[model samples]
Target: MNMFLINFSMLWSFSFFFIFIYIITIFSIIIYIIPSLKNTINYTKFKKNSNFDYLTGFDLYFLLLTPLILFLILNFSWSSYTISAWFGNIIFSSFQYKIFFFIFFFYSLILTAYCSSFYFHSKEIYDYTITIFNFFFWILFLFSSNTLFTVTFFIEILSTLIFLMLATSTFSTTYFYNNLNLNLHNYFNPTTPFFFIQMLMYFFWISLISSLNLFFFLILFYLKFLTFDWFIFEFIFYFLTSTFTLKDIFFSLFIWFNLLFSIFLKCGLVPFYFWKPIFFKGIPLHALFFYICFFYFFIFLFFIYFLLIYMNEIFFFFLIINLSLLIIGIFILLFIICEAFYLKAFLAISSIINTLFVFLALNSTNFTDFIFF
Candidate 1:
């Protein structure tokens, strides 16, 4: 009787989380679809006089498809949340939630691949048509959760590999076309700093995220292959990123204040000097186009990242604070780069250095215990 009661209580809590996520998805879908609700995206003004031709067929296809893609994905996402949240029910526990996560992972993976392919080769209609197929895939996958149409894991893996191969092929073709073979005449010159700095930015950005994903999957694999510790670390990290409150804010400020200082005020200062002139000279259209490919890549990765954050079951305050400070530092760097003013560059760098030191001190000591989920 006591065990039964405990199980029931957990089911109730799970149901609450499910409803909350469902509400979020519904709201997000509505906001994404309703143009009046969206904040105006000023891409036209930002790119005016740029060499790119005005709105191509590819652009029209992209605009028309994005909302539908987002909607179907979110819709299936909510359904999966429902089953996982309610899976404490005895009859559903064995395969429902396991299949749920697998399907969700693949769904996101397919969307990501399609988006990447589009980013690279916008001229292909057959590639774009795959986006429409995702809508039916969502429905079939969702219905399979409760009823018929369940696919074998081997088949699922095969399908995923196909999508990945397509994405790789398209991405390589695009990259090959776009990269110019320009030899550096003066590797030791001041101009070289620009190339090195950009490389550093890309490295750090990729490294931080790749590490996070690697750690996450490690936990998953270990649990499945070894003993089940219930992946407590995964839960802790997820909770920290997704849940927010005044308490989280306070904890973040107290823990990461110094690192924040150094990154924004110190580390980025010299870089700002390099970037200001670069920005005014303007990003090359071809370079911008290459970056657009990268931009889509990052967005796809971020979607996976935050999706993990939302689903993970643990709580950690320090991680969230550090991430927030990182965001602040990025904004400061962007501001300095946009300003193109040397004085502002100096001030921004100085301030960020001080901030970084403070964050360093806070991180060195143990103050995150006060953090609450």
Candidate 2:
């Protein structure tokens, strides 16, 4: 018990320190990039009413996120090697710990770049690239982590907050540009070069907080100060994410149970449809459907949120049944929707396939139920 506690304590401390370094790195990039930006600022172009070159802000943030991301990846790589070398052939306890740092660092970078670039290049080409990258990076991140439930719960919260911010900000920006007649290109774009940087800061800060909270949660559980809520949360997520038939009996039962559990805890689930309509209205049509479907798809996430508050054995089985249904329904849904819409067809198809595969595996007896709770 002492040895386990000691290792747990060290992991918590190391995770905190790693996050600290990560924050410093982002701030350093902002500080470094600002000067070059000031030097490049051309008042004459603004004064003459020329369209602000989209590439400038894009290039600056790209350069900023790129090098630091590379550096972080390098650090994770080196740290992993150091652990292996020190431990020789033994399965060191720190093996998974070291991998989490790498996974976190890489996923953060991919998300930052995806966010930064998506703003400037509204072209279908770049948008899809970034989405694909983010999706794959998220997969790798979840796959590599040592503690699935802790990481996933953190990710779900982070994603929810980010989507809400996006929905709000996009609404505000669109309103300002269309109604107020503010030039989104000249007046707003150049002045707000730090937009992506601010988001990066916010995301990093939240991740740090979540990491700390995870440590405390684990420690308390270890000391028998709290019960492990992992099974409940994880089970719900696995069911909701993996299930296929959306409007079916099994699906409705899951949602009903989730709502019941949420009410019990006094934490209500957001009416997901309300959030997505505004979010989709702000983006291009192709992107609109994409965002809407993605948001709609996660309505199942309510199960996870509710599970965090209350755990019942029946909740776990309900999750599995719904997930099995969801898997089959999503693939057929995709085939129909993609054929009808014909927009961002590749991503549309990919989303369905990916969703189906995740669900199919979830229902299969061989699948791991580790990511929930």
Candidate 3:
């Protein structure tokens, strides 16, 4: 009789737990959809209120609530959970969660600061929705385990969303300028569809190349170690480095080069930076801000995480490559400072310099030194 009662209680508790999750899921979906529906229904009203435009009630609510949600998730021990499988896992340490929460809170502030700049047009509404969703996915990307495939998947999604957001913003700006009959050709050149096409093509090719390199690296890594988990990869790497055969050295170098090249391409480091200036030239200032502050920040964080995982095995190679890159970055920074007349060019150069400094920081032997630098 006692055993039966215990089993019944366990089942009841499980049912309650699932019910709570279901309720939260439904509530979240309702919260997300209602705002969008409200925006749509009030679109015509918003159009007439253009002169007094500001963030909508929903936007303000989202801005205020997101940080609270993140705080609860980060601080509450009960909110800590991990989903692991043979494929990959999504997890973050308490420290990482705290860092992410603070970063996201600051990002929310930045978004709020720029909220007034976004016009209340139909396309703008779509763009705003995309931006919010993209940020949510970015949070997902940050917490994702260092599984190469999973990381690549997130990268592809993010890149696509960025492209969409930029394109939509450009279109919306062009429409706005046309309606106002502005003579600001220098700000957003609507006449240069060809330039936009070229930029799009270049971005596509570069993204494809980066993805392919990462996929090839993933294949090589899986074949060598027969595992996708980064923790397991670290153990295998340590074991191989202990023996350190010629074949192993060559293989490791190839894998390292592939990974570094892909990350550098994504981060727009010195060698792979040609497309960035052109890309930035076409994007609006707000989009550029988002790209620089949020996108690049997370990519750099990912790179740092990657380095922390494999720093022991690849310290010599990393030191040599990073030093060389740093020297090149300094020269590029100087050249840009001398010749960059445009704001976009200056921003591009600044981003490159920031990336180089991050690489330099990674060379430090101590954690405090790394963080301080």
The full ranking of all candidates by TM-score, starting with the best, is 3, 2, 1
lDDT of the candidates, in the order given: 0.37, 0.40, 0.61
Better of 1 and 3 by lDDT: 3
Sort all candidates by lDDT, best to worst.
3, 2, 1
Model 3 pairs whose backbones collide: none
Residue 46 displacement (Å), model 1: 28
What TM-score does candidate 1 get on C-alpha atoms? 0.27
Give the alpha carbon lDDT tens digit for every residue of 1-373 in model 3: 3556546535644564355446545545664565457566664545454533333534655644664576466446545354332223444556555666667676666666555555444535555544654565455545555566767777777777777776666565533443232222344444544435656777778888888898898899888878666666556556666875888878876886787789778768756776776666555566677777777777677667666765653544445566576667666566556425556656776677676666556666643443467
Model 3 residue 97 CA deviation in Å: 2.8
Candidate 2: Cα lDDT at 225? 19
- Candidate 2 or 3, higher TM-score? 3
Evaluation by lDDT, superior candidate among 1 and 2: 2
Candidate 2 similarity to native, TM-score: 0.40
Candidate 3's clash total is 0
Off by over 4 Å in 3: 1-45, 48-88, 174-188, 191-195, 232-241, 309-313, 316-318, 328-339, 365-373
User: Which residue ranges in model 2 land beyond 4 Å of their true spot?
Assistant: 1-58, 69-73, 76-149, 168-282, 285-354, 361-373
Model 3 lDDT at residue 279: 68
- Model 3 lDDT, full chain set: 0.61
lDDT of 1 by residue, 121-207 (tens): 222223333333333233333323321112122123323433333333332334334222322222223222343344345434433
